[model samples]
Target: MKSSEADMVFPVLGFTPDGDIWGFPDLDTLTSCGSMTLKKNMQLDMELVDSRGRRWLVRSIRRLGRARPLVPWLIDLLLTAVPRFRIEQVLEEMTPLTLEEIKARASAAVELTSEYYCAEDERDEILVPLLDQVRAASDVAQIHELLGLDSFLSY
Candidate 1:
């Protein structure tokens, strides 16, 4: 593919557990072949409409990264088999970084992208605490709630 036609990331919504982990591309090309939704086997298909009212069919959603089915299966087995391992403990242990580490990395990225739109003091005083909560979030719901907080919404 030409550099100008390089793939752009597009978010996909699905019922699968790991769907949120990676995004996809090439929906237009994938759909032009045929509509695959009617088969109703392992493959999944869904219809989506663009802003311009164009209809498209999405087919065969697959995992984006290396499959580690065994690891998760083992973890699930352990969760059921072992009495001592709680889901909370497993989640904490599985998380690669602490909230503070997440905060630092996110802050660096945000500052770089902000283009000096907000002053350092304003960002530190207002945004940092909100982002601190965002980084500290343990679950998806918590992250969404934190994002909806007044401090984040006001700015």
Candidate 2:
């Protein structure tokens, strides 16, 4: 389905990594090919609240094989093929982080990140170092940029 402005498009239906199971209430379409424009009633999202005191509406998938990005409408929809995601929109502006807040947030982020990605040694190596940079960052912008997030950010 698409936003009311028609500027962004989202998928209502998603299959598991094995392509065996599907999700969402709309049971009409399941195949990997098709086109339909839908008016927004709901969006499926898995949100993560980062230590930076912002909430990210995230959709995630994991798999081993390579997956090519789909067309413009479905672009950045991270299936197993899509490794990670970038911020499409900033829901709100948060208060500027004080030096103490920055340090606390960075520490918290590192701990969470390490725990989350620790078990999966098969994951990308670059991300591990990036988190370390985030921990050592003196400014929030550095952390945000290192995460490859939010082109909308006016830096």
Candidate 1 structure quality by residue, lDDT tens digits, 2-70: 111223223211111212111113333222111122222212333322212222333333322211256
RMSD, each candidate, Å? 18.1, 13.4
TM-score of each: 0.24, 0.29
lDDT of each: 0.31, 0.32
Residue pairs that clash (backbone atoms under 3 angstroms), model 1: none
Model 1 regions more than 4 Å off: 1-108, 114-117, 144-155
Lowest summed-lDDT stretch of 10 residues in model 2?
33-42
| Residue 55 displacement in candidate 1 (angstroms) | 27
Candidate 2, overall lDDT? 0.32
Global fold similarity of model 1 (TM-score): 0.24
Total backbone clashes of model 1? Answer: 0
